[model samples]
Target chain A: MTIHYPKGMHHTSQVTNMMRTGKTTKKALTFSRRGMGLEEEINVANDFYLANRLAVIHKKPTPITIVNVDYPARSAAKITEAYFKQASTTDYNGVYQGHYIDFDAKETKNKTSFPLKNFHQHQIDHLANVLSQGGLGFVIIKFTSLNENYVYPASHLIYEWQLHKGKQSISYETIVTHSYRIPESLTPSLDYLVALDEWLAHINK
Target chain B: MTIHYPKGMHHTSQVTNMMRTGKTTKKALTFSRRGMGLEEEINVANDFYLANRLAVIHKKPTPITIVNVDYPARSAAKITEAYFKQASTTDYNGVYQGHYIDFDAKETKNKTSFPLKNFHQHQIDHLANVLSQGGLGFVIIKFTSLNENYVYPASHLIYEWQLHKGKQSISYETIVTHSYRIPESLTPSLDYLVALDEWLAHINK
Candidate 1:
């Protein structure tokens, strides 16, 4: 007696076998080379920091309101219906060496400017509130097209946000002038802490 | 022609009318006097604090994974299927007065002890991690039956948790001895910050 598997299934099994044997196959190589999104890279950096006990930052979960649920036999309860709720704060916040850190990670494809529309008024207000409480608040802007990232302080963003009544965006040149560039690395992919240290030094000086 | 309303609907409308007219109907008055659940009360207190710019604490949204969704015409997309994801940290965290505050608000009807079962190992580990990073980590425990609330610092809780290999709960006496009593108030109802200030003062002393 014999069993047959589909071609795709056989291919996947071969890849799994290669991974188990520590052999880098074409699929494995492609997976390794695949570029993560800005959020994914930041999450990976957070995990690295957590494992090394350097920081304790986390992305806040998306807000949602469950309307209906179902309990299946011998399984986890499933949400049958839900609605997204408006978020009241920025994306990431936590403590780093006794300092309160809060920031949002944003990416843009446009290389010329980063539109202010990427942020909401409520988010700006929340960041201001965080700043007033003496916490560090900033935004990590990734210009994907240019393969560049910058840590723009919340204060600078707020200033531009308030002044941009007629303007719709912050020019890339202005961002380059005012923000600290976040150097990319292999282990902690987006080392925003370096930028944070520079910003702290500048403010203190 | 008169629009007919159901009996319950009419009763509710009358109660609402009484509330609007500043006339306290029996039902309306009872509703006003009824105590809110611990979570609801905390939420109300958070709103009050935010409005008054006293604090910036917020409850992290429950994480969920969307498996299916439906986009209806001219309306928001509805999550048709989803599942709750395990949270990696506590419920509430934010900056207050240059301090990073992280905590979970819990309630137990048991008048004698707080069952350690209310906490999970992951939450404890997360709290420890936060503490290592110099963040203030604690739990706001409400003895609902006793109408009492206490802020139990993470260090004390972790000490007991590590010592209690087979113990199922922490005695009320233990909590009373180690925790700071959070006096209830009208505006910022929970007023956990008052307890926090006391804890900080004691530690500094």
Candidate 2:
């Protein structure tokens, strides 16, 4: 293996780069293991953007309400016990190509139809708010059973969710009718932002 | 208590409004005990805008680099081990009032100064990049010791950090010169957006 830098050439960026990541050898023993979480993959993709100075995007920390904390030291506040809280809005949002982007990710095991139950009312409400305020909003739907992924606009998700009483799930045919498929790649693997390009082209005109 | 319908109400919105969060009093106590995280509070504020058809804003999820995960079921994939991959940009970024908003929140225990150690070079670069793009960017600093808060613009943070090699912390006096104090009682308590408002007023002219 070739080393990238000399021993004495340590810099601040190099230190932060080290703090940012670690090299994992691809051991032949691992694939009962799944890859990154949906959020984490997106973060790596965003880093690809940051490395090239393309567009700026990021993910907020998992919001844990720290009910109890042990101040073991002066600087470190260890959260001893905490619980997860329902997120009020979409999980991903940022600026790209002079446009605002907001989205959420949901995965399903079903092969043919995606259940509307995976989405919550707050998410729907959040999407409506972003759209009303004139920002682009959408969802990344992953059909893990088929390894298929698509970007469906939040407008569409809310529309389908509103019909939950009458219809519990949206058929794959319907998703195909309205959603855009994301191509698999190294960076921005979900690559749903391509759908955003189409949305922008159609709307900006 | 009596169950009363506020007119004809069967919709989900009505349901959410009807119950005391749809849990037993004991369960409700546990649920209510869970406080929203900083990101969630910001999300709640964004939801208010969404619900009222105001500006669009959202918190992105933290990007993580997944080294290992256990898929016990087809429906649920649990990430057993993961390290935070370095993010290329700031924590929070979104659109508001047709303008781009970007920021990071850092808390410190010191009442007299905010240590430069809390921020990194990458965050500074991200903020600088946004400003270069003609976007609004800032930092939200909370003095947990004094229970006081301020929104210091990114330009100032970068400026001070450049001086960090010479002086390790940004004195409170220096911060006060270049930052905006955010008071409590706003619907979105951080209300750093107000600082952005003043920033826009100053810079756009």
Tens-digit lDDT string for candidate 1 (A43-78) = 887887787777899999999989999999999999
**What value does the lDDT take at residue B123 in candidate 1?**
91
lDDT by residue (B43-98, candidate 2, tens digit) is: 66666654444466555555554444456665444444444456666766667766
Chain B TM-score per candidate, please.
0.81, 0.73
Tens-place lDDT digits, model 2, residues A1-205 = 1212223222223234334434442121122125756666666767766555556555556554434545665554444444445787777777665556678888888999998878778778877767665567888887877766787887888788877752489899889788876654334444455555556666769
User: After TM-score superposition, what is the CA distance of residue B146 in candidate 2 from its true location, in Å?
Assistant: 13
Report the number of the highest-lDDT candidate: 1
Candidate 2 clashing pairs, residues 3+ apart or interchain: A59-B60, A59-B61, A60-B60, A60-B61, A60-B62
Provide the TM-score for each candidate, comma-separated: 0.82, 0.61
Q: Chain A TM-score per candidate?
A: 0.80, 0.76
Q: Indicate the worst ten consecutive residues by lDDT in candidate 2 chain A.
A: A24-33
